[model samples]
Target: MASKVIHALYNDDDILMLAVKKVKAAKHHIEEVYCPFPVHGLDKAMGLAPTRIAITAFIYGCIGLAVATVMMNFIMIQDWPQDIGGKPSFSYLENMPAFVPIMFELTVFFAAHLMVITFYMRSKLWPFKQAENPDVRTTDDLFLMEIEIHDNEEELLALLADTGAVEINISEK
Candidate 1:
């Protein structure tokens, strides 16, 4: 069976909320929602769970910090230790302040670079990947709600009209 989407375009959050409430009252299935910018309490309005991207970013940053610390300590203290300007080379505990800059740089480098790679991989985004965006305007200036209807097109249209949708379009995929 072909899937149908009844998408409504809204320019304001109030209208969006009213539409959402109407859809809920009528027991319609909403497939997706798109917005130009995040609206306050929007995930709650849509009943969505919080994303774990921040958690993933924190874990990746910690991994980077740990790697940098270990690598710097091993290179400077353990293998081929060199005495610079008569500074002590036996242990870094005394002059650990000198390694702060390098450590900070490595931490930022790993966090930024590795986090981006991980996010892209986890989101399945890669070079030349074409995303299936329903409407280009939805990405910039409009908020869209895609409602799925099995066979009740007339009933769905009535509901959308009652909710004050500015424009409506149907697409089959």
Candidate 2:
């Protein structure tokens, strides 16, 4: 189904930020805001919940640590126990220091790779996905703010115009 939306174009990030605040203050639901580059604090401006990716990363790190521990113990102590650098590998505890770097590296590797995949899944982004952006200029130097159209279209048009928007467009999506 197609829904109506308002697209307000802004030439500057500062103007776009102010417009976002005003729109939110007026109790209008903004569909999204697109910018050529990342703008600090924009998420807060949009009143979005804080991301929980850090917690997932911690969990992934723990999993990686466990896998490394099991693999290292099996390979070093159980499979082929040997003496290296005058140190006997009779137990995982005794040779723990030698595996510290491997443990840390594997933890970071798993966390980073898994985190990327997690983020992509959460955002529904993948290879060959069509662009969802409404304006091509938003990928360049322009910032585009999209708002759902309500019954008070005239009021929204005036408000958007006063917010220093370069262009105002009404469309169905």
Candidate 3:
């Protein structure tokens, strides 16, 4: 069976934020909000759970740091050691300063790359994926809020209109 959804369009992000807070306070379930650009504090206004991507980035950085450490130790200390600028070549501890740049680069590289991949996976976004935003204008200049309909369509529409929505639509999907 198809489920009914109400799409309310807001011309401005500030208005959208206010509408989200109002809808949430009225106990309506908001499926999502789509906008041309990110709306600051909209997630909190919509009462969304906080994301943990930062923690994952930290873990990825640690992994990268470890890999760089081990790889540098083996290549410089065991595989092939060479003297440069009279620096000690026999001990990794002695040559630690020389490896600092590589370690920092690799740590940032892994964290950024892995974090992007993880975000893509979590969001189910990939190349050639079908667009899911209901309104094309949402990608241009509009903000859309999707609400599930229970039984009070009229009341919902009226409330959405009162919240400064420029356009409101309903569909079953």
Best by lDDT: 2
Measured with C-alpha atoms, the lDDT of residue 154 in candidate 1 is: 93
Considering summed lDDT, which 10 consecutive residues are worst modelled in model 1? 39-48
Model 3: how far is 153 from its true place, Å? Answer: 1.5
Collision pairs in model 1: none
Misplaced by over 4 Å in model 2 are none
Q: Where does the lowest 10-residue lDDT sum fall in candidate 3?
A: 81-90
**Per-residue CA lDDT of candidate 1, range 1-173, in tens?**
79888988988877898788778778776888888887777676677788887777677778777887788778988886888888887886765888888777877787788778888898799999997778888888888999887889999998898888888999895
CA lDDT, every model vs. true structure: 0.82, 0.95, 0.94
Candidates ranked by TM-score: 2, 3, 1
Candidate 3 regions exceeding 4 Å error are none
Model 2's TM-score against the true structure: 0.97
Candidate 2 local lDDT, 53-111, one digit each (tens):
99999999999999999999999999999888899988899999999999999999999
| Displacement of the residue 35 alpha carbon in candidate 3, Å | 0.5
Q: Which residues of candidate 1, in runs, are more than 4 Å off?
A: none
